[model samples]
Target: MTTQTKVSICLPTCNRPDLIVECIESCLAQTHTNIEILIGDDSKDDRTQRMIATRYQHEPRIRYVRNTPSLGQARNVSSLFNRASGGRILLIHDDDYLAVDGVERLVSLWQRHPDLDVAFANQYEVDQAGHVDREASDRLNADFYRTKSAEGLQQPPGRTGLIQMFPNNGWMANADLVRRISYKEQYGMCCDYVFGVELCLAAKQVYYLNEYVSFYRKTDVSISMTTKRSTSAASVSAYAFIEKLRLDRPLEPARKLALRRIVPIVVSVYSRNHDPIKGLRIAAKNLFAYNYGFSMRLYYHLMMISRSMLTLKPR
Candidate 1:
């Protein structure tokens, strides 16, 4: 069937020139031919630019733009959104790619349901050396997306609710949605969480496909997993931003009640890669003092107990 819905895959990349070629190649191989692959490169190195231009230069659909000065991660992603031309924009990270026929499936479902404001399916987690990990799917721990329809609304405009939409930051939404909201600069690590909340709150309908469409390569080098002393500040800032967003919105009594149930889980997420005591300290100093209420207090007290129990559990 002929379709007019154009999809733009915006890939924002940096230093990894070697991995990017495969990433672009995967997009080029999509069965859905109506795709414009926009590459926003932040690398100052001419070699990376030369490599992208040389390999995909012949492909008319490929548009490569190199930033004169690196805009860093979050802004570069936001920049790519501004430059995107397709009706649908997929904010693909540098190290990720669509599975074969992945774009086709997304396009097909989107075409079938034009009313959906957003759509995201499952994605695979590949290892650093590029070996596909069959087990990463298990870690997701829920059929949250599969059971849901292609279009619907998400509730509670904050981190807890946003994670349910696209767990790995892989999905396609209307380009207009991208323009409607900008990533919260304050939350460096969790900007997507804030953005997702904004999108879900605005969207009348959202979609979730059970099938896995993209491969998220998990490596020590990837930004999210890496822990350094310098990044702790940024991580703490993200948590504070999330706390503020959660508290700012006027929510119903029931949803707020549900949020109370989930605070300890949120605390543990922040502590997984860092010291538990330090993460709790950040939570207490920032979220507790500024945003504490029914849920925050419940979470703080629960986190204290959970942290101790966690220490006792065998790894």
Candidate 2:
């Protein structure tokens, strides 16, 4: 690729007029000039569109699209990719903003390592007040740092590392590759995880840059935070997708072990949405089939009991 390779920051927004400006400004502030900020606005009101029109209308690198009646979240985000004209794509949420030179650093890394199919970096989770929650951020990303090699490069822990630490908003990839493995519209909450796994499995080489790429705002209103109440169909679909990968892919022993460790977490979520009986049945099937560790089996057993107790009706 040439030095002038364009990078598209595909941001999908809906009723986030308060935060969308900062996101757009961050994309505009990138040191790399060869970039475009594609905003697919799904806001019910005209606030976001008006703001963009009034403030960023003259900016040549920003392309704004307003949905007539709102396309919801998944389709709205997927549409941004359809309109993107860059060689590389970074799908960022409207509430999340880059670290000023984040795009420049990512582009530079890709330029140095031209063979990389996808590149991701660590992120700082900030609050609604824009304060970095260092404690929470560190806790969330501790695994990646712990697994870092002596060469400063973080190796995938196992075959399923990509699925486990799929950078939801802190990653960039070749536009062509992303387009080929597009996000599934049916997946409501776990689309990014599913897409991330697909990219990792298909990629020739996935790189992890040490730089902090973006600030992911952890607000109560975010999809992840809101979806914790009930197990979303999307979450169930994502778990099933991973299970299919485990069965179909000729994974190494380490990878299968890593996957086994992740199954209980999915089962817990499934239990919260459905019932403990269903969760236990699925858990038992996997535990017996995979011959999971004693600790994992114990954890699942406890989870089933806890869920059952929680669902008990008042006499």
Per-residue lDDT tens digits for candidate 2, residues 183-249, read 7876777787777777777777677766577998888887777775466744566666666664334
Highest TM-score scorer: 2
Cα deviation of 62, candidate 1, in Å: 0.8
TM-score of each: 0.75, 0.85
Evaluated at residue 251, the lDDT of candidate 1 is: 49
Tens digit of per-residue lDDT, candidate 1, span 221-311: 7665664333343344444544555444464342333333334445555565445665466545544333474565546555664665577
RMSD of candidate 2 to the truth, in angstroms, is 3.6
**All candidates: CA RMSD (Å):** 6.6, 3.6
As a whole number from 0 to 100, the lDDT of residue 268 in candidate 1 is 55
